[model samples]
Target chain A: MRKYLFIYKSEIMSELQYVFNILIGFIGYVIILFIFLNLWKYIYNDPNELINGYNMNQMIWYVIITEILWSSLGGRKLCRKICDDVRGGNIAYNINKPYSYIGYSLFSHLGSATIRGILYIILGMILGFIFLGSFPNLNILSILAVLLSGILATIISTLLIIFIGLLAFIIEDSNPFYWLYSKAMLVLGTIFPIEYFPKVMQTILKYSPIYVVSYGPAKLFVEFSWPNFITIIFWQLIYILIAYGLCAILYKKGVKNLNVNGG
Target chain B: MLMVVKNQLKISWLSIKYALIREMLNKTTFLTNIIFMVLNNASFIVQWIILYSLKDNVGGYTFKQVLLLWGIASGTYGVAHFFFKKAFSLSDTINTGKLDSYLVQPKNVLISAITTDIDTSALGDMIYAYITLFIYGVTLPNFLLFTFFCIIGGIFLTSISIILSSLSFWFSKSDIIADTGNGLMTNFATYPDGIFKGIVKILLFTLIPVGIVNYIPVRVMVSFNLGSFLIVIMATIFIVILAFLVFYKGLKKYSSSNLMMAKI
Candidate 1:
């Protein structure tokens, strides 16, 4: 485990050497931040009119939290990378190594995700301060819930990515799947809150793991309840266990073919 | 020039057929596209329901009026996707060094590149939009005139797509521009143009230019304004000509070596 920790750290250090690329990525995030801020600002032009349960400030806070949660734990690109590796024969090299392939991927993904999480949180903090001025009377328990949700969001995202990436072994050009999945994230990830959805869609979303990742956590941070908080944590554990089962099944099936293409 | 166009059309047809066949055979692409189309339309339908619940008209558009606008816009976007998906993926082609193959082709490079990856899945959106339009009880146009407008709409949209895509040659990456352009168009196109005021309205007419795709024709169709429709036709011709000139000019600085077209 210590050795793998070193590997993960070393891998991240090398990637950090591409400082320019990381900076470019940060610029991309900033652009999205600006777009969302403007969009919300337009919607909240008159905060006095109470639309739904919350005012403009609260609604925009939802936008901020959702955006941060998404940026931090959205592992779509990492999934694509995993798919690329599986299809491109890079996974074969890892399989021949001493550690488990899933373990290696998890570590590598963690290293990168830690960086993204930090970047997203710091950016969100700055934006929140600039716009909302410090905290909005958020409690310590709510803060803890937010942190727990963030961790679960990361796990759910990583597991979902790993599952989809494994599809590359069975298919040609996993991009079509990746593209559709990413779009699904737009709906599922609270780019528009699930409340905006129709009754049927709301029902479907309630049970979807996506809700736990984005909606559950964001809701907790904004409106705290001990029962709902415990419920979300329970769902997270359930999802994690299911994800582990899926990983084991998919890896075994994918390895049976063992026909990795490209170098 | 006439001969160049004729030959380009012929080659584009062949490439389109080949791509359609490839996509049809590829179950993954076909199924994924189908799911995406359904989900996209579903989201729009949900949004419309919410908006319709609040009021009969949003920004001066009746429910059916907005549906007509969406029908035209989404149908036009669908057709664009159906035939010119490769052009839409210009950044990918450029980044992956796949542009070399298109460059080597005997046909117009842009036409060939665009026709090569036809997205037939867009047909679903086209069908859905038109069906909705029909269900809304829009009066039937003279068949010949409707056909003429459809052709003009296709060309106008293609011109806009080409101009947007050609920016990739000048920039390191143009995906963000493409995405932003598409997002803005999709968001704004649902509402009537009359809602937008001042600089934004003017910007939509000029800079974004999505107004050319659905707004003008649908407006004319609804009001039966011959003058406006004719103006739209003329504008379509002007833009297509402009797109060609700009693309060819950009080709001059192409520098088609391995360095410019870096392999992914």
Candidate 2:
């Protein structure tokens, strides 16, 4: 645990050099948000009107939060990195390393994401305030819970993505798999709240990882309730464990298949 | 001058052909790349399908019109990436002095610099574009018009990337601008133009130019009109010319900063 924390801290220190790299991503996020803001305005003739229990502001804010998370977590960086390491045979050097590769990936990614996420969070906040005023009604406790859930959401997403990255052991490239996963999240929850989806589809998505990975915190931010908070947090916790366990199993099997050539 | 233009076009075509032949060496990778791209695009359209299910229209676009807009967007993207993948990477070329090789080449520098590789996945985008067009309802005339728009949109999109990416000649680390420019063009082109208002709408028509790339083309597809068609043609020519102008002008400031890496 201490070694992981040290790795995480050192990675953050090293990641500060790439602040400009992350901040530039803000422009892409702003454009997406701006486009959505306009689309929502056109959708709801009245700003006060509600669709599936969300007003224009709620819808817009939902997009902001989800976009921030989506942009911050990135779609497939870790998976691609893992695939590269595995395919390029660089993972063999770490075969006897003191630290576990999965732990290193998770920490290093979080380390970098910590910087990028905070900036995007700030950007998302400012953009939300600028485009739609203050966030939809939320108390301090709910806000804290939402933040906690957001962190958990990132963890689960990271672990799952790392698991996909580990697929470099068996399959060729994990990118094709990641495309499907990311697109599901994008259309299902990141771009639009599940409420806009049909009733039957909504129920399935609610139970799916998209709910815990994306919709949960954003939904809580827009509309806060204790019951929803408990359910989202509980599911987020479960998914994190499930995702991490999957990554560990995959990494173990992948390492066994690891063949290194050229000393 | 006409002969020179034809020769340059021939050279560009040859460069692209050779690039395709090289990619053909890896048949499975190339085919998978194209297929995955199509699947990626199909996944995104599902968002609109869900949205359209709830609303009859979005941003002055009917479901069918949305399909047209998306089709043209994908077509333009396919054209740009498949043919001129380096246009998006022009800033890197200029910054790292990769442009030096093209400068020394006898052929047109911009054409040579851009046509060195193809993004095989963009071929999938091309396939997806036609799929959407066919689904939207295809006539012989409609098919011809769609092909024209895709060809023009491809050139226009490439020119947009080149013009933005050429900024590296005057500024250090301007790759972000180029990347954001590319992202803006690709992302905004997919959305309906009617939703954008005020300065953003104007900007989309002018600077970012998704309006010219997909919006106007989609309109022409919906209802054929000579004036609009001519505008598309003229706007495309203008953008292509403007791209050449910007790149050449920036070239004056370009200095070779190659770091001893041999391309050979």
TM-scores, chain B, all models = 0.85, 0.95
Return the top candidate by DockQ: 2
- Model 1 chain B is weakest, by summed lDDT over 10 consecutive residues, at B255-264
lDDT (10s digit) by residue, model 2, range B1-264: 898889989988988898898888867667777888888889877788877876899988998889888899999899889999999898888888888888877789999899888888899999999999999999999999999999999999899889888888888877888888888888898888888888988998887788888888888888878898998899999999999999999999988875566653
Colliding residue pairs in candidate 1: none
The residue-by-residue lDDT of candidate 2 on A1-263, one tens digit each, is 89999999998999798887887888888888998898888888799998788889999999999987889997487888988998889898777889988888898888888888899999999989998777678888888998998989988888989988788788767777788778888888798888888799889998899999899999999889999999999999899889889999998988887787886
lDDT of 2 at B180: 85
Q: Write the per-residue lDDT of candidate 1 for residues B1-264, one digit (tens) a residue.
A: 999899899888887887777778867757766666755654555555654664566656677777777777767777778877776677666555567767776778877777776766687667666665775564557334444555576667677767776776788667556655655655566556655567867876777676776777667666778788878878888988887887777666665546444321
- RMSD list, candidates in order: 4.6, 1.8
The DockQ value obtained for model 2 is: 0.69
Residues A1-263, model 1: lDDT tens digits: 98679777976787667545444455545545554555445445476566556665665667677777666654677777888887777878877788877767777776777776777778777876787665556787678777887778777767777887887777755655655565566546555667766679888987887687777777776666889888888888898888768877888888888885555
Alpha-carbon TM-score of each model against the true structure = 0.79, 0.95
Model 1, TM vs. native: 0.79
Docking model 2 quality class? medium
